[model samples]
Target: MNGTLINYFFHCKRQCYLHAHKLKTEHTSDLVKLGKYYHKEFEEKDEDKKMINGVKIDKIEGDYLIEYKKSNSDVKASEYQLLFYLWKLKQAGIIKTGKLKFKDNRDDKEVNLTLEKEKELEMIIQKIKTLINSDQIPPVINKRKCRKCAYFEFCYS
Candidate 1:
């Protein structure tokens, strides 16, 4: 139920399941390398990176939880990831808005967890649990975006 799991659930169910089972392939991905680089650079600045339970938050200012992404290619996945973080914080009695920052662009998006969205997120979380706990792997998407995924080779070749 971590943020990465939430993000992967939206990005690809197979990826989420594999990751939960510790079949990590991120180190073999250039895109993943770039993302790690961005996070490392941010961490080097000694900026805000605080962990609440199992979720790692990038930044927090006033009433906002800021998330940094290496690219804007998958904003939807990122948004849901941030929403999961917000939901986690709320469980700890901390409610805040979510802000997304992309290193590849200047387009920043804000996310708020409304009652409707919260309900949706809760349902998503349950679905993710069921998906990752199963003995089966989801079918490969086989889309163009799949070629760029860290699990591309593992899924295709």
Candidate 2:
């Protein structure tokens, strides 16, 4: 889970560990609830989260790797996450471009990541791995990322 998408999820390291290890979070936030709702709405009727070459792809449509985003404004992180998914999809022989956007709104304001972006995301994944191995929770003093973070309680505590 040290991929692009996971890297953007930077509120708490312990939570990241649980997610990376595929452990479910006992408590979820309203945002998580909204995402689940959106996924149910937009994902293909048969789509289920899949791990392809160690990458967790939310869904795939033809030659597109689809990853839903639920961000208030910072959409770049979501784009990077989708790039990470595409990078993994490439490894799984599902090479394709990726699109990241709000699932519920469908406002057409999307962050599209190119193959180059995927490479950039690959570099970022390395950095994230190093940071995680060091066992440090990068400060979110401004709390912008923390506000909507699902593990806010754990992070604040």
- The model with the greatest TM-score is 1
**lDDT (Cα, tens digit) per residue for candidate 1, span 29-147:** 99889889997876676566778866788888888998888888889999999998998899998999999988888988999999999999989999999998898999988788898
**Candidate 2 residue spans exceeding 4 A from truth:** 2-26, 44-51, 109-115
> Each prediction's Cα RMSD?
1.3, 3.6
Model 1, backbone clash pairs (residues 3+ apart or across chains), number: 0
TM-score of each: 0.94, 0.70
Per residue, candidate 2 scores C-alpha lDDT tens digits across 1-157 of: 5453364554455555545544454346887787677766666564566778887666666656767655536565565666666666666777676766575466644445566776677677776677656655555455566667676775577
lDDT for 135 (candidate 1): 89
Off by over 4 Å in 1: none
**Residue 98 CA error for candidate 1 (Å)?**
0.3
